[model samples]
Target: MLKKTDCCQGVVNRKDKDGNTALHRAAAKNYPQMLKLLLACKADKNVTNQAGLTALDVARGQVNNRESINILGVCSFAGVSTLYKLWQLIVKILTEASTEIFQDMDGISSDDRNALLVILGLLLTATYQAILSPPGGVWQGAVFIVAFFLTLGLLKPFPRGFKTALQVLLAFFAICFQASIYPIIPFYFYVPLVINIFIFLVFVIMMSMCTASRVSKISVMVLGCWLLVGVIYQSFASFGS
Candidate 1:
């Protein structure tokens, strides 16, 4: 039918009311043969629907449809632009969820707030000790220590100037830590380093946005501890080598 008429050129790109083109419908339905036919007809694979999701995104959301995902993966170029869009989507979702959570905190009882404060204090002490007596006794842990304290300050009711200063200082120390580790990271570890840097940046942004929230403060503390542990393990391995 497509070859007999101008349907391949006209109907292939035409979207329904939901903004899904022929390729989008085929991909969502996991119709590999139809998907191939549509692609052969020059269907646009990147056209987003009303939800601003591409065919690839729709395929991904179908967790049980591995065949569809694999088909879409073969057709799509895993380029930087795709990754950037995915990252933007993730940041948007996290920001919205955190903002909603923070906004709903007014109903918290005094007891719960006190409990959170106690937990934060314990985490602060643990982080301080980890800094003072770092794995392999390396002073590189100082960078993380600075970052931890700056993040801790965010949970407190500090002046606007002071809070802004802490945020800047925290970001600076986190970046410094990444830079310092880069020299020691092996060539094969380049990918891991990039991922670590990305996670650090995300953590910094989240901290900046939800500074006074208990959930954000606890998350930062836990992530800081986990990152420190990884750095320590890597340092020890390097020393052994």
Candidate 2:
């Protein structure tokens, strides 16, 4: 849609039979980078679909990511088997971390901070190198899982501004790391990158929403700044090259 027509006009004119624009679809599909891009192109945020659903409505549906997964008639492994496996592992990590966050002190007494720190350290190293090196998606996936745990570690009882600081660090590094990977990944796979990055944004936002700390809010803003700058700079640099 963005390719055939100017982004602004396409978003303006393209609506479902139900009167939803690309923005509606993007939000429904949990595509924040797409949402940001559409908004940048002046998409009408106020526009309601035929069902009277706003972008926020669609985003809200994604709040419970694992819960809303439709197992019925959903072929889990017929296609993209490796990615499906990866998805399962990612979900497991997210779910476990989420559970740990709410668990009691006595329950968390079993939580190994050293193990967590080691995993987080390893993930940062692994993800940074994985993109620049040969195909090591397994390692990359491990990094993602460890990072999810790291986020959980920061979430519970966050002090004045720790959660926010961690998110900014994660978002900044993730953006930079992914930007580097973009050049290596075939342009055809750009959609996956877009979709996952959108999910990343959603995860970051969720972390912000769940936390009462002010730093989390600040972190979101700073991460947004980095994403915006990264996108613009990447586009210009890539185009010039």
Q: What TM-score, computed on C-alpha atoms, does each candidate reach?
A: 0.31, 0.42
Candidate 2 residue-wise lDDT, 36-73, digit = tens: 67765666555557776555555556765332233111
Q: List the residue pairs that clash in candidate 2.
A: none
**Model 2 stretches astray by more than 4 angstroms:** 1-107, 136-142, 162-164, 189-215, 228-241
Model 1: which residue pairs collide?
Answer: none
The C-alpha RMSD in Å for every predicted model, in order, reads 15.4, 17.2
lDDT (0 to 1) per candidate: 0.58, 0.54
As a whole number from 0 to 100, the lDDT of residue 232 in candidate 2 is 64
User: What is the Cα-based lDDT of residue 157 in candidate 2?
Assistant: 49
Error of 2 at 237 (Å): 10
